[model samples]
Target: MHEMSIAEGILDVALDTLRQHDASVIHSVQLDLGLMSGVEPDSLLFCWEAVTKGTAAEGSRIEINTIPIEGKCLDCDKTFPVENYKFICPYCDSHFVQTIGGRELQVTSMDID
Candidate 1:
């Protein structure tokens, strides 16, 4: 599905990096995946393996760091995890909670030979 496209994009970035650094192969690709990024890790991994066939990143590893949803309470001035998709602040039961983290989908780094 969309994971295939995402995987392809990742490969493109890795290849571009490889060429820029004049590296022979990509050893690994690191990614920051947040809880609300809506990207499936399993599907992404499967697509990654399929798309990397015969390429410079053929056997490269995909390292995903999962980030949890965090929110900061404007009323209580406290930060906590947003559970069960509830935006309410746990400290003050306030609805004015702002999301501080999560919802991330970015390539952080790559390891090359």
Candidate 2:
């Protein structure tokens, strides 16, 4: 799965940051993963465990903050959560809607020791 590669990327960043701060161990990694990002949390966690073996990040916690899909209607100028992947505007039933958020996939913070 692609999560393996993703996990490797995360480890790379964590190690780079550890070197920058001169830390000996990493306690945790926080990520902002959105609902529409299409990345499975469980799979990512499993891959993380595999990729971190014998590394400084081994046994570290991974905190995933789920972000909801949000959209804005151009017709009514109203913003609301996009339920069930529906792009229709709730206020005006308009098809002209712009997605405002929920595609995030990034590491926000790390706890190092």
Candidate 3:
């Protein structure tokens, strides 16, 4: 699955950062994952163990912070949380809504030795 590739890329970055900082061990890798990012957390977790096997990040914890989707309605100028991936404005019932957040998929931090 694509999650395996994503896990591989994450491990690559973590390994590169560890080398760049002269750190030999990684305690944990933290990620900011948004609801609309299209990356499945369960799949990523399942692939993480396989990808980190025998690597410097082996046995390291994988921490994911889930971000909720937030959007702003153009008609009413009201900002609200998006539910069920619906873009409809809650206050104005308008379809013209702009996404303000919940599209992120990035590594935020790492606990290293």
Candidate 4:
């Protein structure tokens, strides 16, 4: 699964940071994953733990902040929740809309020492 690669990449970055900062241990890693990011939190966590192995984050925790699917309707000029993969405007029932959020997959920060 892609979550495995994503988890590996995240761990690569975290491990590199730990080495650079001379961190003694990593307490946790927090991720800001959106509804449309297409990444599974459980799968990512599982992969994270599996890849950690003997690394500094071997026993670290992963906290996911799930963002809802929210977008702006271009036709209706209103903000509404988006369902599934359709980008329709809820108010005007138009299929054209601008997504404001809910497609994020970034590492905001982490707890380390």
Candidate 5:
């Protein structure tokens, strides 16, 4: 799965950060994962467990904060949460909607020891 590559990328970043900070252990890694990021959390976690073996981040906890999809209707300027991949406006029933958020996939912080 592509999650293996994603996990490898995360581990690379984590290891780089650890080296930069001169840290020996990683307690946890926090991430902001959006619902529309197209990355499965379970698969990423499984890949992480495999990739981080014998490394500084081995056994480190992964904390993910899920971001819900939000959109703004262009016709009515109504902002609402999107459900089930539907981008229509809830108030005015407009199909012209622009995504405002929920496409993020970034590492926010890491707890080091």
Candidate 6:
């Protein structure tokens, strides 16, 4: 699954950073996850435990900071939540909407030992 790959990548980066500093453990990881990123929190949580089973990140807390789905309406000049992934602007009934946020997946920080 893609979540596995994502978890692996996160672990890889954490491991690399720890190795550089000769650190032996990772206490926590902070992640910024967006609603539009199409990631299931439960799935990611499950993968985190499995991926970190034997690594320095084992037992590390995965903190997910969720980002809201925001969009800018082209016709109404208003910004609102993108419900159901629809691009239509509710106020103006226009289909032209620019996504303003909520499509991000990134590692915000890590607590290393």
TM per candidate:
0.89, 0.93, 0.91, 0.85, 0.92, 0.85
Q: For residues 18-103, could you state the per-residue lDDT of candidate 1 as single tens digits?
A: 99998989989999999988899999999999999999999888999999999999999999999888999876799999989898
Taking the tens digit of each residue's C-alpha lDDT, what string does model 4 give over 5-65? 9988888888778888988687898889999898988899999989888988889998999
Cα RMSD (Å) per model? 1.5, 1.2, 1.3, 1.9, 1.2, 1.9
Clashes of 4: 0
Relative to the true structure, candidate 1 reaches a TM of 0.89
lDDT (Cα, tens digit) per residue for candidate 6, span 3-28: 99888988998899899989999999
Give the alpha carbon lDDT tens digit for every residue of 33-103 in model 5: 99998999998888889999999999998889999999999999989999998999999999999998889
Candidate 2 per-residue lDDT over residues 4-113, each given as its tens digit: 99999999999999999999898899999989888899999999999999999999988999999999999999999998899999999999999898999889999998
Model 1 clashing residue pairs (backbone): none
Return whichever of 3 and 4 wins on TM-score.
3
Give the range of the ten consecutive residues with the poorest summed lDDT in model 6.
81-90
RMSD of 3: 1.3
Q: Please report the TM-score between candidate 3 and the true structure.
A: 0.91
Model 4 error, position 77 (Å) = 3.5
Which run of 10 residues does model 4 get worst, by summed lDDT? 82-91
Which residue pairs come into collision in candidate 6?
A: none
Which residue pairs show collisions in model 4? none
| Candidate with more favorable, higher lDDT: 1 or 4 | 1
CA displacement after TM-score superposition, residue 102 of candidate 2 (Å): 0.8
Would you list the C-alpha lDDT of every candidate in the order shown? 0.92, 0.94, 0.94, 0.86, 0.91, 0.91
